[model samples]
Target: MDEFRFIDSIKPSYYRQSSVIKGVGDDGAVIQPNIGHELVISTDTMVDQIHFNLNNMSLEDVGYRVMVANISDLAAMGSSPLYYIVNISAPNSVTNEDLLYVYQGMNDIASQYRMDLIGGDTTSGHDLVISVTVFGNVSPKKKRLRSSAQIGDIVFTTGYLGEAGYGLSLLDSHKHDKLNYFVQRHIRPQPRVDFVRVTTNVNRICLNDVSDGISSELNEIANASNVSIEIDWDKVPIHKDMNHLEHSRLKQLALSAGEDFELVGTCSKGDWKLVRSLCEKDDIKVTEIGKVINRGEEPSVYLNEFGEKLSLDQSGYQHGNS
Candidate 1:
């Protein structure tokens, strides 16, 4: 179908939020910001084969993946999702029905978070591309930032890591026997938005979503906060499915492979205790991986493996690096 028809076809019957004054079928989307809250916005773009491969993932899965990528950023900021805008384009080979599936995919995940679909452009392109911008709100008092970590703070993670990257590998190798858990993680990973919403009552928590892997996120926290961080290799959580992988390879996946989308953060000891209990009560696995320290001139992340202290480089998925 054409662009206007595609846009009109996916417009919601009703907006999820009353704050959305003008959504689809408009020159611009107008939103009313809530009082006593700051807006948290995040956007992500996914290319055809680079970000996703249709061999293993469907267009709808791509839509959900892109939407989650942005929502996960809001989760890292401890914000609640409010609205989203999706811009999609594909080549002539893709039918209107295909685009419908894409929009259906976006709606599938977004509706769960009470996010309203706002305005975005739709047009033809050389490749199937999807861009999503998510908007959320956070209380100014409970801001969670990468630079908010403190010395003596405890490092923690919301859930298991490296599954998504491993999942992609499993898909690439056509390992159907071991595909269910990891494949789902690769295509339809859930953001830890609820965990943050429940456990962020604490005053200070430094958070980075594991979109780019734990090492990258940890280094970001350390650099942003100007503090050194050390996490034991044995403490990092990996799935039982990955236990058979070689030592260094498994650790590398857990440390450097990206797209897991878990939340890694630091908070004070008391605050960590409180959040740990709260997370358990909510049935979310929260693990104490290590602690923040002051041993380095330049802020850096160190992973303790085989009793050896090794500095962690910014090792994760970097677009266009390959």
Candidate 2:
């Protein structure tokens, strides 16, 4: 099938969210925004070989992973996903049926997350690249920006760290398929949208998706908030499966191997009580990983590992540097 036919076929499968007044087949998507709410939008792209490899991941996993990466951005902002646009560029090596499988993965996430797939472009290219832009909305007062961190606030994570990174490693090493827990975490990360939804009424927050790992994320928050943060290595949560890893490898993965898709953020010490209470109600456990210590020029992040205060470098995957 050609580009137009592919778009036509997927039109009916789109999840028509109330906010999307018009979707697929149009020049643009028409969206009805909620009154008194702030619009939250984020975009992400994944390329074959650079971002994903078929040897370890299916085309569908690539599609699903890209969508979740975008959705996690919305979750970090404490917003509910409303609509999304996806652009797929496929090479001669990629077939129309393969694109459909990718779409199925995207559609699955959209259905499960209550967002609509609206409009985007399809093209033949030298590489298989999927780009997604997601739209969400939150109360104006509840917006969670990386700059929102405050001194004395408690830093937290939505779930276990390092699982996704290890999962991808398992696939790369050809040791386990996608069904493995760590592998599943890498391929299909669960965005913390539900937790954000439940705690929407909480105080202002500082948030960054652990898309690039906690080290990079914490540095971002520090630079944005102009605040230094301190955290104990032992406080960093990990899966029981990761316990077998040597101390150095576990530390390396938790610190710099990104794509966890969990939210790392901060709230007032008092507000954390409410946040924890709210999360526990849904059987979700948000781990308190650290605390903001100072606010000033030249902000930095310090990790308390092996009872030593060690400053962290600006870490995680750099797209073009590799």
User: How well is each residue in 42-161 modelled by candidate 2, as lDDT tens digits?
Assistant: 999898889998887877888888889999899998888888888888898887788999988887888787788788888989989899999999888888899989999999988888
Candidate 2: pairs in clash: 167-182
Clashes of 1: 0
State how far residue 82 of model 1 sits from its true place (Å): 0.6
lDDT of 2 at 243: 97
Candidate No. with top lDDT: 1
Q: CA lDDT of 48 in candidate 1?
A: 92
> How much lDDT does candidate 2 score?
0.85
lDDT of 1 by residue, 71-121 (tens): 999999989999998887789999878988888888899999889998888
Candidate 1 has an lDDT of: 0.87
